[model samples]
Target: MSVKSIVAIVVSLIILVAGVSSVYVVDEREQAIVVKFGEPKRTVTTPGLHFKIPVMEQVIFLEKRILSLDVPPQEVLASDQRRILVDSFARYRIADPLKRYQAARTEVGAARLLEDAMESTVRQVLAKEPMNEIVSGQRAELMKKISDLTNQRALTFGLEVVDVRLKRVDLPRENSEAIFRRMETERQREAAEKRASGQRDAVKIRAAADRQVAEILAEAERQSQTIRGEADGQAVKIFADAYGRDEDFFEFYRTMQAYRKSLGKDDTRLVLSPDSEFFKLFMDNK
Candidate 1:
């Protein structure tokens, strides 16, 4: 091969390598920083293809989108001297890539600092509030206070504190157990009171029912007695009418009734002569 052709080919290869190395693409979700010897020169917030000095400058990409930091759960004491477990987290995005690289050097380092600040601020702010406020009364207010304080510290790390929240707030094991016992005792006392009230109501109902039964029986007896007296009076009137209509026939009917009454029983007996008054009527008939 000719020397001129060899030189041209070598130049083409070098240009290709330089072009490929100089060109870098920035993603939509990311930002880039131009660095030399670990020192940041400038930040590129826009996305798409970009150019850099080949073999002279390096590009460091940082997340442009919001990031999350899960602060480790820690036990904190409230202002009221109550201890609770707080699980919290934060959302943030790097506002200044140059500042972020200078302070934290990496995303992981930034997150660590932010988490530490969040945990510290949580303790500091929450410890000035009561347990009720921390748990529910002013939970949002307390978290906001923590977020503001943490953001103040996060400035050093070049991170913005978007939101801070507590996922759960709960009492200690011993407190929970004691509360449960007290609740159980309260429920048992309520049940006993209800049972006593029910028994009292039952006694009242039973007494009322018994009184009504006695009153009904008395009324039924009164009605029965009134009817019986009326029937007896009517029968007596019928007998008197028959007697007044015919004297001899009435006497005969009375005698027959007496005979029936005396002899109706199968074991009836009488030790008397044939001329006894009971048989006088028979003799007269004969």
Candidate 2:
């Protein structure tokens, strides 16, 4: 090959490299800014082939679509003086490419900036709200306040906030455990009071039942004694009437009853003359 041919080929390759470097493509999902000598020249949001000074100008591409940022859990103090842990997130977009580039050169850096803003804004707004409102149904209202405040802070970074929300809000671990213990103690005390009341009522009922039983037994005993006395008096009157009706027959019957009782057992023994007065009835009958 000739020396002139080699020089011409080298020049052609250099021109091709320069031409390629001067042209850059912009994606539909991104917007860009051209900076010449560290100074922003123009902002381009159109997606197409673009041109810039090959060696002195640079293009910075930024996301044109909305972006999401998940913030880490942060511990904050509420207006009610309670400590709470919060997990949150925000949706945003790069509204001004030049401003975004001036604030932070890359998306990752911009994200960090936004995160700090969100953290600060969340703390500021949540600190003014009570713990119950932050954790209960009123959380939506508080989140709106936080989002509005964070949007104000985002404007400084050339970012537009779409929405901000708290994903989870809860009491600290120690606080929750303490509340559980207190509730348990309260329930135990209530249970003990109920048991004591039941036992007192049981005692009263038993005492009343015992008194009723004693009264019933005393009445039954008195009635039984009265009936026995009446029965004994009637028997004595019948015996007297029988004796008056036949004196000799009653005497004979009494002597027969006395003899039966005295000799009723096998061990009975008696000594008397066979013709004595005690045997007069027996001798006459024979």
Candidate 3:
């Protein structure tokens, strides 16, 4: 090859390299900022092929999709003066690429800065509430407060904090054990109180039932005695009426009944005169 031909080939390669370097494609999931000589030239959020000065401009890619950062567990004191471990995380996006590039040059740097911002916001917001409030249904409200505060603080960093969440808020092991013991004691005491109350109610019910049974039985016995007395009086009236109707026949019948009652067995003997009224019937029968 001739020297002129070699020079032409070198120029073609350089142009190709420069053209390739000048054109950078930004995908739908990414945002980019062009920096010229360590200064931000322009930020491109739309996804397309973009051109820049080959050697002077450099492209910095940032995530346009929502990103997640899991915060490490942090020990914090609650408003109630109780110490707890909080594990939290957040979701964010780069809202302003130029500002984000100026504040944090890379995605890792942005994440680090956001972690600090979110942690600070969590501490600030949670320090005003007790552990119970943080763990209760009001936890969503508390998280919203933290998220709003973080978003406000992250505005300068060009980050839009989408959500802040607490994965776990737990007492220290030592404190949890102590609380469990106290809860157990309280439950046992409540159970004992309930049992005592139930026993007292049972005794009252039993006493009432016994009293009612005794009253019922006494009333029944009194009614039975009254009926028996009325029957005895009726029997006496009937005997008197029969006796008034036939006095001689009734006397004879009564005498015969007495004799039979007195002399029913052979072992029975009476020392009475043969002409006695008691033996008159026997004599007449004989």
Q: Estimate each model's TM-score.
A: 0.75, 0.77, 0.80
Per candidate, the number of residue pairs that clash is 0, 0, 0
- Cα deviation of 195, candidate 2, in Å: 2.9
- Cα RMSDs of all predictions? 4.1, 4.0, 3.5
The lDDT per prediction is 0.90, 0.92, 0.92
lDDT of 3 by residue, 66-175 (tens): 99999998888889999988999999999999889999887889889999988888889889999899877599999999999999988889999999899999998898
Residue range 1-286, candidate 1, lDDT tens digits:
9999999999999999999999999999999999977777888989999998898889999998999999888999999988898889999889878888888877788898888889889889988889888888988788889889998998876788899989999988887899899999999999999999999999999999999999999999999999999999999999999999998899889999998998999999988898887776778573
Better of 1 and 3 by lDDT: 3
> Which ten contiguous residues of candidate 3 have the minimum total lDDT?
277-286
lDDT (10s digit) by residue, model 2, range 1-286: 9999999999999999899999999999999999999899999999999998899999988899999999999999999899999999999999988888899988899999999999999999989988888888588788888898888888888998999989999987898999999999999999999999999999999999999999999999999999999999998898789999998998898888888898899999889889877677778674
What are the runs in model 1 whose C-alpha is more than 4 Å off? 1-26, 34-39, 47-59, 76-84, 123-149
Judge candidate 3 against the unseen true structure and give its global Cα lDDT, from 0 to 1: 0.92
